[model samples]
Target: MTRHLIYLSIMAAFTACGDGGKAPVQQDTVIAATGGPDTLNRMVLIPGGSFSMGADDSTGMPDEYPKHTVRVDSFWMDEHEVTNREFAAFVAATGYVTTAEKPISKEELMASLPPGSPEPDSSMLAAGALVFTPPHHRVPLNDVSQWWSFIAGASWRHPEGPGSDIKGREDHPVTQVSYLDAQAYAQWAGKRLPTEAEWEYAARGGLSNQLYPWGSEALTTGVAKANTWNGHFPYDTTTTDGFTATAPVKSYRPNGYQLYDMAGNVWEWVSDLYDVNYYAQVGNGTANPAGPAKGYDPEDPGQQKHVIRGGSYMCSDEYCRGYRVSARMKTTPESGLANLGFRCVRSVANHGQ
Candidate 1:
């Protein structure tokens, strides 16, 4: 999700102490209430402590390797990704329209879409946001049309293009939103999006040198623990994890942090810029270091792209394996997709002040 520009979202269940470090649930697990059940029902208690951020060697991306010590203060995070009901309240409270819902400027269309890809054939460019359902598989990341489509009438209301509705899945993670949309919802709920380092730290669940959130084992072992592609690339999906689209948050097990669906589900947005070599400059000891203050990905330098964590259902061994704690990707601010969603954090000091 790229809002004003930059984005991310994810989930879990069961109440328990967070990764060992400091406090218990009674410490940093307070949740703010919106008008309805839409608000994230659960909150993870992240105890402030120092842990090794990123992994060592070529096992991880250049940006997530050379694991370094990083210390984060205690903070509360939404247990599950923000749902439709919750976002709806934010929209209702403030008539905030997302960039996806905004009309596509001829300039934007020409800039985002492939050249010669005929102009949008609709009443307006805002017919719908790009959804992952269209591609539904592993395709070369460079090929934009392989995964994204300008569906007509698709918005946050209809995650699976315009035909979808939040009927039985109001509790499910909301998609097709920009980072700004998620930020708006977080602000309205009195929270903020988690930073890339914070999100990975929480997802790792205090485990050192881990690959995925659960364990070194993959989601499929005799049982499907998380939602990801099972079959071939860019084609058949066995749905072994259950459902083709975004599954309800927490359908899988929780990590050491008592946080659910952190590995495979939907790719979550994070508050970090994409710096390919950010890890090489890691500082010693545990310190919360934000990525290069104002860096942009070389791939899409014209548009401000922000980092997204926790790979999506589309990730496969043959393609993207970013579901790991240190893995991440970036998207344009105005880009919207079914595979993208978001969660939030809040400053305890801001609770009263």
Candidate 2:
């Protein structure tokens, strides 16, 4: 089984970006006391303050270790992850092609593989994106290849591969988008992807060092505050939240900061490059810290990685408890998965003007 799985996985890798549906009315106005109109972007102002940057609890992961104090300047953040409808509008206006829509680059493919790997066949280099394909029975968690497939013709338009379409999922967070694709959309919208710090701070929702966006309680407490896998993972899901896969971006209640789907829904792209030792290098009470200069993952040193926050619908307490606010995960910028998406942020100075 291991040898068979390895052969199947050798060509597999990538992230999420979804296609179009109904477009929403972009509210481009700012809040005002009088009858003044609102803005097209829905943003919430995050006040600048100092807080613990990572996890201090046992449920935290290794990368979130050595909890340190960090402060972020005030900024405005999107209320929800970018929706399929919004991404569709950007595509229609700019005719932009996402990274996943383009052919898999040999250079990128080489970067992700083990050192001295052979050149890939032309067929494996076709334009495609990573799509989640759950196995029939329980597979060893060590081999992710059992669940992820690299399919040709898979792009933002066809999230689950060639025949899949966004259709009625207009409000669902766009999946299968690479980090570069997210950045492109953000630039066109005059916004940018949030830094890991900013993302975590905003996710805190005025709370300090809480386990989740809701508070320091395991996700088992309430009536499914966020969309996550119920029952088992990568095999059988109960869909207790009424979604077998991606749910509407606003299906859950907003955090204390008035942001929706911060805990679960999809893994959100952040601007920071991933470095295992980044926290140790960060000074106490650092302000407006961007992140490490470059990306590194010891598991795959050949691949450059960027930080992704928030958990996805596939996340479960058993396999991946990534919904915790301080939880961290890293993937190549060129990689797109079925459960990965992103939101944007704007500097305070650029809010009204």
**Candidate 1 Cα deviation (angstroms), residue 231:** 1.1
What is the alpha-carbon lDDT for the whole of candidate 2? 0.78
Q: Candidate 2's residue-wise lDDT over 1-353, tens digit each?
A: 11112323655553222332223332321111121112433888999998999995876878898899999999999999888777767766566777777665667565546666666767667777767899878888777787877788876778998788887776788888888888888887888999999999999999976788988777767687999888777899888888889999778889999999998889999999999889989999999889999776676665568899999998888778889899899887766778999999999998766
Tens-digit lDDT track of model 1 for 1-353? 23212111110000011111211222111122256422245776788788787863376666677778888887777777777667665665566676555565555554554355454333434445665534545566544455544556677777666566777776678787777677667766777888888898888887877787776776667678677777775567777778777788878788888887787678887877777667777686747766777656664455556788888888877667767777878876455677888888765565433
Please give each candidate's TM-score.
Answer: 0.82, 0.89
lDDT (CA) per prediction: 0.66, 0.78
Clashes of each: 17, 21
Candidate 1 lowest-lDDT run of ten: 7-16
